[model samples]
Target chain A: MGDQLIFTYIVDGDDFTRAGEASSSVKNKLKMLGVDSDVIRKVAIAMYEGEINMVIHADGGTITVSVSDDDITMVLSDSGPGIPDIEKAMQEGYSTAKEEVRSLGFGAGMGLPNMKRFTDEMNIDTVIGQGTTITMKVYL
Target chain B: MTIGEIQRVLDAQFLYGEELSDLDADFVFSADMMSDVLAYGEKCSILMTGLCNSQVVRTAEMLDIVCIIFVRGKMPDANMLSLAMSKGIAILATKHFMFTACGILYEHGLRGGA
Candidate 1:
């Protein structure tokens, strides 16, 4: 593989049906690159959860995944209403999603915690009324 | 057990991947929330859920779940079916509710993953 390979995807918030497209694409790409299955699974799940969060709360976002020999890094950025309380949002069962989202089998307040649980490292940067950016990494 | 046996056990109808009936999975996870599935579903090869949507299939694909059993007679739309087909993930539908379907699978030796 190259020293570093990067891929970016634009997530459309209006379409709930298409939320995990980017993560799926990345997973296939990593598979073709011969990345470890466990690593690929971790990246896919973390990014998929981030993708769902972007759709449900951020209204839309851009996800950039970079693959290298040592680790894989994913950055999810959004320009919607930012997370007001990172601490609360990080809780396992604290959620601000509506009933509609719950009806779709999501919004159980597990997105951020699951993201953190799956990845080796996760960082969140947010500003109230502005936007949020989440960066995650998984070591190979 | 093989997916075929699981189908017979739960009286499920295959919506896709009927050819994969020979596939075997020892562990099964049941949940409606995709996040919970993502969090703890890695060790399980079969996912049983009441949620019917494209994201469910997408979640299965990410987790490499061999099959998804939609309980309570919930049906997945064409787009979801095609997506699951393309990913080589089997889809099953049963009239049994989540509790009963899971119980049947458990009784048949499909244990939950740690």
Candidate 2:
């Protein structure tokens, strides 16, 4: 409200069930702050997809969300196996998730695209054998 | 149609949020993949899925889907039920398969919107 409201979360990669916890919390907070429903929906969906990716691919990570007057920004960082090809990964049906993840109703290769679709700005930074960090923003 | 009517049409048993059954909805979206639901599921009031997990409830929460219908009589675990309860999203379990459940709701005038 004043400067920028910052919320951070540690995504547990081992527990798939708890993946969306941070996104849900942020969504509720945004609602309490009287953010527009459409904006809240965008943030929630993008953040939730990032959360799922963290669990399914990255094996855990950190998510930092900052809400400002102009827009809401989400930064998700993970130290997992970095993506090999950002272009291929961005494809709507390109996925490297395992079969087990598919059983959970995800790994449909729509995570990154969906994230990009719902957010106004999205950037993915990855280094092989290092990690990956995704930054997404949805204008308020 | 209201959630109560859908329940009656499908002979669904409420796993949670039966009090919210009186809530009305006209659009239905059925999917086993949460990604598909998130991608094209806007304005959909009810989500019908055979996938029973906490993410299903979370997906519904993100989409503002008021109710989830689990086909093939699949039941949600305690964690999912608790999550849905806190989110005020209703849960229903029906014995019909995905196609059957969707058809029944479609026949009852619940159309899937574009």
Clashes in each model (backbone N, CA, C under 3 Å)? 0, 0
Q: What tens-digit string does per-residue lDDT give for candidate 1 at A50-99?
A: 99999999998999999988899999999989998999999998999999
Model 2, retained fraction of real contacts? 0.84
Q: What is the lDDT of residue A67 in candidate 2?
A: 95
CAPRI class of candidate 2: high
Decoy 1 TM-score against native: 0.98
TM-score (all chains, Cα) for each model? 0.98, 0.98
What's the TM-score of chain A alone for every prediction? 0.98, 0.98
- What does the TM-score come to for chain B in model 1? 0.98
